[model samples]
Target: MMFRLESVDARQYRHKSKRVGWTMAALLLVFGLAFSQLLVQSFGSSFWLNALGVLLGLLATSLIFAWWRRRPDMAEVRYVTRLKQHLARVSAHLSTLRQASRQGDVRALDLLAFYHQGMAQLETLEGRTMDDDAERLAERLELRKQRQLHGLPEEVAGFDPAELDAFRRSEPRT
Candidate 1:
């Protein structure tokens, strides 16, 4: 026999399952009491009617429980709304990064790298590509780096010896 597992969170599943079980149990208990009254009043003559009533009660309980479980919870609805808003903000930020890089802003390069790293992590989790525009930005940054290295001015001034020493000390050893 094949069993189909639901994809709900474990906590949510446990909570909902417990609630459904309790509801079904209560419904069965009430139906059992009512059926016992009918059986007693009929002098135990309506045997088939009693069995039918029990089956109908079970069917009603199952249908109600299934309907309740199938409805979307408020928490899940709010979560999806927030997720959509966050994705929209990310798209806008990525567009801004692309525009800034296109204008030859060096700071945009660092920002793009940071953003790309974060998107790469998300891509790994989601199993999809999230860097279509990032690839072009990366290429442009590489070209700009090469240009800056080759067009350097001679005798660069304002050398900070302390900062240089600190930076060197912070480097990882090979």
Candidate 2:
């Protein structure tokens, strides 16, 4: 099941898997109460023992539910932090790629490898960003892909203005 990690201000929030699990869990309380009632009737004991057992059962169920609810919140924070760190690492690797590509040496192959890795990481991060940030930098990434495509051609010859124009158009404005 897809779980949405919602953010409140800068903090994170997560749905507690709805009340379905809670309802199922409450069955433990129901069974305990029924068992307790049966025991009270069969043993001719005072009502307090059965009542206490039922109360303890309810308390245990409540603690389990509370723990289950907080679980996703903890997981959400970890997931977000890991994503942010991954993005940072990808960005740093891309910078190294740009530098190596500038040198125009055999190391360009290494840069290409890094570029491909960075693109994969960027793709993953794109899915996890805030709504308004979903498509951020995607256009630039497409332009980068187009530039790589153009660079693959061995023939440039004289500077054709049309080809230059097309290349310029494919690149990010800034």
Candidate 3:
């Protein structure tokens, strides 16, 4: 069975995840401290039990934070996941989407803008900002500068909801 997920805000989710992870780690430390103190008070200086508490707390903190870091909702995964979601909604994959965009299809243009943005983000994640990728840059320039979409901007940095709105309004309804 398939389940639909509400759209995720990758930046917000990541920020919140970091906060929660830190909070959890802090809580573990506090619990360990309290546990150690209690053991010392109840057992007339229990070194081994205190050490065990510290060790367990550290293990839990590491394991939990590692799991949180690996969540699929991270910004890195979101770039690709969101693109796939958009394509799936329109029953198109990367190759077909690219072909449609090349033909100047409206929906394709919208999706292509997202694809380009995702590619750029992926590049940033890979730590290759200074590297000039000739082919990718050329394609973006060709579309944004050369294509005259009657009422749109000459340089579209990313997908614009208003562009679609204007286009839809300009065309007469059947």
Q: Give the Cα error of residue 93 in candidate 1, in Å.
A: 47
Candidate 2 yields a Cα-based lDDT of 0.46
Query: Where is the poorest 10-residue window by lDDT in model 2?
Result: 154-163
Task: Give the alpha-carbon lDDT of every model.
Answer: 0.49, 0.46, 0.57
lDDT of 3: 0.57
Query: Which sections of candidate 1 miss by over 4 Å?
Result: 1-8, 39-44, 74-174
Model 1 gets an lDDT of: 0.49
Ranking by lDDT: 3, 1, 2
- Put down candidate 1 lDDT per residue, 1-174, tens digits, no spaces: 111111234355345546656878998767766765676577665767777667766777777766765576634323333334433443455555455555664444444443443344334433456457776556546645633654632212222234323433543355
The per-candidate count of clashes, in order, stands at: 0, 0, 0
1 or 2, greater by lDDT: 1
Candidate 2 lDDT, 13-109, residue by residue in tens: 2232234355647766685687677777887677786876677677767776557645755554354444455435435545444544454432332
lDDT by residue for model 3 (81-151), tens: 55445434434345655565677766656545555654555444444473478877876775564346634
Query: Pick by TM-score: which candidate is best?
Result: 3
Q: Of models 1 and 3, which has the larger lDDT? A: 3
Model 2 error, position 110 (Å): 50
